[model samples]
Target: MKEFDFIRTLKKLSPLPWERTVGNDSAFFKLKHKRGLISKDILLEDQHFFSSIPADALAYKSLAVNISDIVSDGGTPRAFLIGLGASSNHFSILSALFESLYKYARQWNIPIIGGDTVYSDKLLLSITCLGDAPQNPWFRKNARLGDYLYITGTLGSSAWGLSKIPTLGHELSDPHIKRHLYPPLYLDFPSLFKNKIHAAIDISDGFYQDLTHLLEESNLSAVITPETLPLDPSLPPEAKNTALRGGEDYELLFASPLAPSSRRWPPNLQKIPIAPIGKIIN
Candidate 1:
């Protein structure tokens, strides 16, 4: 069965209070004084990534994807737990991975709280991120009809980078390759657009597919203008399809009531070029 089909089956079995969190990027629940948000992501060698990938790159991407989920929901990540399944107990690889992971952890000011490790036939990484939820956290179901759809940064760079990896050998010097390996994290986005964003999802599974998730959850549709897509100018004309369907971009695709030209955004955020690509429709 397909991934969504399996998810649908799981959702049916989910408990009443948790059902709403099943399909969202992060699970939100009440805390003593403030709400809490949590998300988990798993990466497997030869599946989510290649075994040839460097330990540092693999570690960074694993943490980044999970953090993206928390940020998309308008949460500030507080701490994370990691579960590692190693095929072999190689100290060098493990050390490098943790070194990179901790470096990013310090940079984000989030701590590595705890987790477990196990022996396996292949390398596997599972990250569970916990964060402080915003007053009105963004959700896929919160998108309203007529809300404008906007996307951050560019698309297709990660996919383009992946394609070149076989030839370029994971060189971080190439922008595309670097994007595929170390996706740019938008940690400050939620704080910047806190009040304006209605719904949001990180573009890890391609723009079209992830947008479909947002629309489905909102019980709405959308009308997208192809020309409005913020495709990277460096990409070739033929890369449009890749930009639409290529996964692992890790950029934010969100809905907002404010028009693309709305001056309601903060001055600093105004400088970031968020493209209005589509609008939620009936």
Candidate 2:
């Protein structure tokens, strides 16, 4: 079975209460005085990334992706726990990873609360992120028939960067290479839009696949205008296909009745382009 099919089977076996929240970007629950959101992600060497990737970049991407999950769910990240598995000989790498991890944690003001570490033959990293959720968190199921589909930032840069890794290891000065190493975080997006968004998902598994998740959950279809797709301008014309199907952009894909206009966005958010590429349909 495919990854999503396996996930569907697991969701079927899950308890009734959790089934409702099981498939979202983040799991939501009530906290003492506020709603809480949580998500976890794992990365393995040679699979998700190459061994030659800089420790700092690896650490940042690992933690940032989990934080993306929280933000996609309309939450502000608060803290995280990390699990690391590496052979003892890689202590230097571990040290650099932790240093960079803590640096970003301080930069983002999110704390590293707790987690476990184990020795393994291969390098592995896992992070569980916690956040304060909005009263009504965004979900894949909340899309409406007339909502416009919008995406933040450009697409395909990361994929393009990945293709260059074999030829240019650790040469992150290249913008595309840097994008692959460190994805831009949309930490303030949730708070900025708040209740304006109807549905949301982060583009981790390519535009087509991730958008399909929202459509399936919302029981709707979309009509995309080919011209409106926000392909990375830096990529060549042939890379248009990569923008549509390549994964790991980590940008926000959301639905709303109102089309997003740069004129209305704050200066900071304006720097991150938003484009309406499609709309929901029956």
lDDT of 2 by residue, 23-82 (tens): 554444434445789999989988888887789999899999999999998888987777
Estimate TM-scores for all models.
Answer: 0.85, 0.85
Clashing pairs in model 1, backbone N/Cα/C closer than 3 A? none
Stretches of candidate 1 off by over 4 Å are 1-32
| Model 1: ten consecutive residues of lowest lDDT | 10-19
What are the candidates' C-alpha RMSDs? 9.8, 10.0
- Candidate 2 backbone collisions, by pair: none
Error of 1 at 73 (Å): 1.0
